[model samples]
Target: MGALELLPPDTAAVLREAAARTAGVTGLVVNIAVGYGGRREIADAVKQLLRAEADKGKSIEEIIESLDVDQIADHLYTKGQPDPDLVIRTSGEQRIGGFLLWQSIHSEFYFCEAYWPDFRRVDFLRALRAYSERNRRYGT
Candidate 1:
């Protein structure tokens, strides 16, 4: 969530806050998960894995063959946090928009016609209710 493919317009302040927040902070954690492309995130994970293995003196073939889901997940920024249970895509858009691509592989998606500003508590409750009704396989 901290790492990004691109930053939104004028995000210096948010970045500063993110830097200051430590594990001891008890307030709401606001992560700016932006400018991220799903494919790019996967590639970045692979790159990190390669670098780590190389640093430990792994051969190229060994690194490639040893790659696994856990290694890539550790490299991902959202590794420690639980993957989202539901994604609310507002403003009438039904697309996934590439948000949390790898992390949200099994999340329930809720598309709303209202914009973020207009998305109220009722909308959120509705999303939760709908998710409760579905039988998720959790990727089996």
Candidate 2:
């Protein structure tokens, strides 16, 4: 499991410990967001990117010239992971509400009327089926 660094130090420590304990386990990586906000995450990523480039002795103009979507993505919390292909919004909410803003640029969405606690395996299957039926153009 992975989480944003914005959590309290004690909570962050617990998350780290959990990660260390699970490092050897294979498959089924679950990423949980704690005290996470997509806008804040993007802002934090940009801050880290600027700090890294500055430490590398790159001038502002040089950094600006070299910056790209991938560079920004590399600094994001979910770096090195593939973007989510399908996002199922529960609680009858049709909107994503700022979830995975940068990473979900091309994601497919499925809004369900049931609340998350009421969601079941059958609902998940339906979501998967819906995803399979789409001709995923990935923004063209």
Put down candidate 2 lDDT per residue, 1-140, tens digits, no spaces.
34536667787788789989998988554555666789988998999999999999999999999999888999998897889888888888888888889988898999988887699999988998999999999999
lDDT of 1 by residue, 30-102 (tens): 3444566778888888898889899999999998788789899998867677777777788899898877788
TM-score of each: 0.76, 0.79
Which residues of candidate 1, in runs, are more than 4 Å off? 1-32
| CA lDDT scores, all candidates in order | 0.77, 0.85
Each prediction's total of clashing residue pairs, residues at least 3 apart in sequence or on different chains, is 0, 0
Among all windows of ten consecutive residues in candidate 2, which has the lowest summed lDDT? Answer: 27-36
Worst 10 residues of 1 by lDDT: 1-10
